[model samples]
Target: MAEARRPRAIDLYSGIGGWSLGLRLAGIEVVASYERWGPANETNFKNNHHQAQTVDIRRLSFADLPDGIDIVVGSPPCTQFSFSNRGGNGDLEDGLEDIVTFLGIVDHLKPKVWAMENVPRVAPIITKELESGGRLHAFSHLDVQTHILNLEEFGLPQRRRRCVAGNFDMERLRAYASRLERLTLGDVVVALGQDPVCDPLYGLRIPKAQLVDHDPEPALNPEELRINRANKTAHTVYNAMPFPDRMERAVRTITATCTRVSRESIVIAPPETPDCVRRLTIRERASLQGFPITFQFYGATYAQKLRMVGNAVPPAFTYLMGHVFQGTDAEALPPLASHAEHLTAPAPPAVLTPPDRPGSVFPPTRSFRFAIQSLQLKSGVRFELRNRFADGQTEWSVDFYFGTSKNIIALQMDHALRTRLVMAIPARLRREVETALAGVSTYVEAADIENMQRVWTHKGVGGTRPFMLLDELDQAGKGLVEVLQSEPEVSRAVVDAAITARFGDDRPAVGLAKLGRNAPVIAAGLLIGSAANGALRTHHLRTTGRSPKTKSH
Candidate 1:
């Protein structure tokens, strides 16, 4: 019998080779890692012994990739979708382009298996687009699965909930995931000998006047200092002011934003001396992120190094995921080390401390329906999006949470309600409506938050959880562009058909006079009309090579 061939794979956005290393250890041959960051690329090369390509992925052709690739894994930049950046569901910025490029590569390569790891918020957007049967219809054949996972559940130290979307048997994988022993921050910290030590300043209680001289709480605002002294608020760091990693429970998510200069994000108070808190060292952060001590990071600044570590999917999680993906027996895997036998739980974040709110409840000034309708003005349909407050408290502040809600009306052409509206509009007004809707949607989506402070509180807000719906749209648009660019004849045919059916060949400029200030309404109508019947469907059919009647999995 012939020896079984090692499964070949590639890792895109392979920061420090976290996924590559994990997969390779699980017997998958990770042939190449495509990374644009120079320092991370260097680390990937040094550790993984694979050459890292620094090219823009959008320009990469199928031919540029290695042959016989059985799997493709990517963790596209999650900055725009991350809640920490500018609250959750901010502008797509450059992350949208990256998503487009990633989808293009997947479509172009047609890998036997693929997985995309992103923050949990992005799960819905990814699933929506994949199921939309739009440009991504080509991927409809695979048995797609979406796993909403928290790393702490997998026996890692930090608490990070992420979405793993791919073509795999996730049900079975989830079952396997449930059996892993839970690891706490204390266990790994103790195992690595990161012992707590009393600070030299522990005995000294400096007055507020002398706080500047002591500088123990340099990052605290004047108000925060007042709160610290009066309310005994914990020394704060980052906007979230993460509590020190407790031995018993998991630490909050580690962000790429953790830096020496901006050392407020990942604070750890020594278990022995709670007041002697300090920033987590590189090794501690790496360990918290599940990087083996042997894996070295090479970077010019502490920021760069932290970025690599924070961006990585924990290797322990990846290895386990890879094993499941390859159908390896869960019981046969080596037992994970549990330092619980030897370690004690440390103190968790103070944010987790119970609040002492006055025992009174105020009746709502507005109902959910009324509040939702208030946003549904002629300007644009608005809704109260759900979001977390600065202290990690769940809240529904109208001013702070506008754009993140999936319920907000963005002009969807295929939506049944919108389709009827589009049909009612005269053919002459259809083009104008389409243009106006695009413009209005843009304006509404970009509307200013009435109260910025209410939206960006420190304690209630956490880092982003990967909501990338705009990025999905951008990806779909790119896929459509690719279809048009690749086949000019088909593009022309589709365009002609759209123009003739929608407008009766009446030039687009003809309706400009009537559109005037009503551009938004007309645009909204046109958006629906165009979506219901357009050249996009032609491109989708060609791209997927499936009949309209064929069901997408």
Candidate 2:
């Protein structure tokens, strides 16, 4: 009998080799990696991956890629599409460039399997691009799937809601994630046996804040203290972020940065000194992110190290994903803990205590259609573009609600409930919250709120079960708020594209933009022009030997 061959793979935007590490653990050989900003520090991709290349993907040759590659995985930068940076209003062009660039690599490699991780907001954009004869028509022939998934549901011990899209098995992903015991912030603490103060990684090599033997919370300057003071408004609907982030449940998502004032910051006071607390140490942050204790990040500075850790996809996550890609049964593999006894989750951020509101009608929930998703993803039942165009419904209007988690939940109200919902708010918390919003004033009107698909949390189907969670509703929302937040800019970009196409027509330029927000017909038409297949298309063809499909094709 012959021996089975190990699958070969490559990673794009391979920050510190998160995808590579995970894949290698799953019996896949990560033969090559591409990252733009490879810090000169020793603990980077060059040390970990078999062939880490700092050369930009745009500059690489098809000959540069490893041969016989079977799997491809990458977490393209999410900053441009994330809500935290600018309320999901970052540079769409730059963000789209990275996405298209990633697709370009996939096109050239034409690997057997691939997947991408990004904020939930990016799902629609990619889905729209992959539609029949869409902008990224290259891989439309393959069975690609996109879904907004919570990583915690996959047993990674983090309450990270991300969009996982690719040709990977949806059933296997679901089954593998749940196979391991669901862990919590406390479980992570258990995994990281020693405190940062005692760890070898934390000694004189890291930041002073991380090395402090003083009481946990670092001494804050006066301004930060003023901003962080505890508060209680009769109108306060949110459950307070616990002093030390909770350890029982999965932690909140960590990003490339952290701060004292941000709600997402993980503040923790050691059990012995629970009175005062401090933000997570670099090593602690890495553990929470699912890196083993032995994983040495060779960055020169703590802040730099923090960025590397925060930006990585947990190797544990990729392990399960790799199993599906390689046709391996994840259940037969060892648990995530077996990788390194030092493994720990970014201990969860909050001690959840979901609260109630006065509506008697329904409670809020950040579970689905968060401020951005709710604005964009709206519907349990869907309607086609033609159907929507023919409906003759008036322009959409803005509205608000609190989620069960107390995070602001933006809802696109119906016409009939416009006045009622607005009038009802003064009695609840919206009066104050409305002002907190960046001065939004549009109103949805005349649609029957009672008949909308999102049955209020208080009720379930035929009252048979509590509608505590709406999985499908995750696909809905993003009506007026999304437009209001992204437009003017999006409109301006479209307008700019139109101008370039018209004025530069003689100079070999055409207007094409990928706003990801449902572009206007005229704008969409412009997008379907020559530019979609121009530079990106040429790059794909030059790198790979195949001519990719464009909208014109």
Candidate 3:
């Protein structure tokens, strides 16, 4: 009798082969994979002998794949569907493009069965009626069943809930879910701590259980640390924090941005020293995602490693589904008792919502409150940040306020973002700002503006936050002085003198006075208007090349 061949399958968007690893372990041969990211594709090649194609799915053609593949499995990018996105809804265009391409691949292959996985919110989008024949014919009628499976139910540690769509039998998969034992983050931590055995076949560097993906975060003061310990929760920073994951249970979904320290990043303190909390290592994160101990991730930096791990589907969960898909018998396996019940739960409302500390330039009054509360100011606006000397090595950092409609906002500026904001200004203004900033020795990184924007939404408000540009000469820095000198009758000294004398004061005045010209009374009427009722009311405007408009009385 001739030996039977293993069933063939193709994996798309195969980040680190998480989905394919499971199927391969379940007796399926994943011959090829389609991945656009270079580091992730390298990981796939290392784990499985997948001839991964480094082509964008949108541009991939049917001729690019192998013949007679039985199944097509992929988990398209789900960032756009994630809840972490600001305002809870991400841009649909990016997610839709990947989803369409994945479907197109399936349509091109016309595999016996195809499975697509994404965030639960994406279920409707995937199940919506999509035309076939041109790209993916399997989605022509959109008859595929959508299964909302929590990875925890399949015995993988994570509590991630993903929407899986496929033509395969769901009951068969559900039957096998009970056959696996419950896993947790503790198990993953323990497994990763074990020393790697030397493999004679492939001599890869066996990294120890040391911490990775750690960034240089500002250390908390002793008092702050004490407070955090007493509270036993993630500390608040920059008004936003990530929801910390409980170690006893499966972690929340790992995100690609976890490489950078965030409030939501999982923090663990060793049993001996519970005071020191640190982000999880890349290897540990991979283990939490159910990659085997022997599995190795190759990347030049922690960022690449984190991105691969965060985006990968847990292999253990995938393996169970793959086993069921391959018609494996659901023989009852011994159930392991879960120990998570004994672990004490953390305090509710994960983010610590403490009131913002008082700002130097702006007070904590209702007027200032409305400034920060308004959602109208878009991200990436530049503000002139000033650090004025206070007491003994302490300086008060203040954001320059800009008026918008009825609200006022102080622009936040970080070193890296400030450089980009200055550079991005109009060519003539940029030259003047740069000339005035010549003596300042801070580093300039025009390229890092986007990265800074990802973390902190506000910074140097160049033209973006233009509430009182050139209004008061004292408020204008040397850079602003140079830029404003272009206006008629405006000079550096003239601006200084006007600011000093407080002439043409726009703010509300407390008292009124009468004045005459040439020592002769031109008009006997007293100046009745207060500064609040001055004609020069603050004007608020966006940088969309439109004139500023003052609110009506």
Candidate 4:
């Protein structure tokens, strides 16, 4: 009797072989994988021994794949649709291009089944009818089902919520789900004082050197400390994370980008030095995502390796999917039970628990409420942001009030974005603003003037309280130097002085007379009237020999 040939499959966008390894474990042969990033493809090949092709998926057609690919699985990049990106406000047209390509191949190949996964936000976009065949909208004709699954339920040790759409049998997979028990952070990743029940293989993969604690985060950087603290609130005071992580339930989502600055990176206080906090090592992060110890990731930099690990589908969960696709029974493996040492360990110091959250989201001593309620530019454009600021720092829709339009939002912008917007202004004007800024000790931005008509959105970082952008739903002249509530440091005089110098006394100057203490130290914009705007444009056209772009205003 001859050995039975295993059903062949292909993994697209296979990052570190999460899908490939899982499917293979389910008795399917992952014959080939297609990825565009060299590091990821190289890692896939090294680990899984598949023919990893660094080909652009857009150019792939029927001829490129093997004749009989029983399964086609891929995760199109989720940057555009993810809520973490621009608060779910990314350009849909640009984001859907890759998805269109992925679906096109599935349509072309007409495989027995296919699967695609992405952040939960992508669920509505893919399922609802979109455009015609040239694009991927309205693919209900393909007959695939979409399931929004939480990895915690399937026994993974992190809170990973994903929308998986596939033709694989749900009933078979559902059966596998029933037999599995939920696992928590303590079961996998190492934490302070934990006697972990993590797989022994994980111990083998982590070097003894890697087990050493990271140096403590600087204690005095108040702003970084504030951000980390706010993230426990998760953009709201309503839902909070255990400060130094309780290790009781699954930890928060493990993002592709991990930093100590945001709560997404698991923070722990070493038992030996309880006050000092450090992030989980790379090996721990890998373990959190359900990658076994022996799995190797090849990359030039630590960042690249982390990206591969973070972006992967949890192989533990996928193994079940492989069984569903292969029409086979999954061996019932009981979830790891909690170890007594892990359950009884002492808590990390300082951050994890407080009946009430620490510090203030908005300055309690804000001067704006007592000062002026609103500020009007000399040109009659009225601006107001105090009410928003008074609402809370915990809730920032408009950190900088530009005007009254939805496109022009009022939100607290991080330093990087603030710098980028500042850099867009012409040098001469920039210099002028900077010179005046010395008096107010604030910033001058083209966002209120040049970017007035430009649509702006904020991306929410996972595990952090977002300075979520608030839509300015006022009249047409959206965004004004409204009496926006500001940091305690920004005084009424500061706003008045900036407005005075930025627009000069005679130009469309912002009048801060209405604001006092609470007035938002808005990085006030130059309120260039139509005539002045035209003059600046004309000057630029003559100076540079370029046709003027009519301002969208």
Clash number for each model = 26, 33, 12, 32
Per-residue lDDT of 28-147 in model 3, one digit per residue for the tens? 899898888887887787667668878787787777689989888998888887777774579876778887777767767778778888888877665553444333345565456788
List TM-scores for all candidates, in order: 0.53, 0.56, 0.55, 0.58
lDDT of 2 by residue, 394-444 (tens): 111122322233233222222222233233332334343234221221111
Where is model 2 more than 4 Å wrong at Cα?
40-42, 46-49, 190-226, 229-240, 341-553
Q: How are the candidates ranked when ordered by TM-score, highest leading?
A: 4, 2, 3, 1
Best-matching candidate per lDDT: 4
Candidate 1 runs further than 4 Å off = 131-135, 194-245, 259-264, 336-553
For residue 329, model 4's alpha carbon misses the true position, in angstroms, by: 3.0
C-alpha lDDT score of every prediction, in listed order: 0.52, 0.52, 0.50, 0.54
What C-alpha root-mean-square deviation, in Å, does candidate 1 show against the real structure? Answer: 21.3
Error of 4 at 12 (Å): 0.7
RMSD to the true structure for each prediction, in A, is 21.3, 20.9, 17.7, 15.1
Q: What TM-score would you give candidate 4 relative to the actual structure?
A: 0.58
In candidate 3, which residue ranges exceed 4 Å CA deviation? Answer: 86-89, 129-138, 194-245, 259-261, 332-553
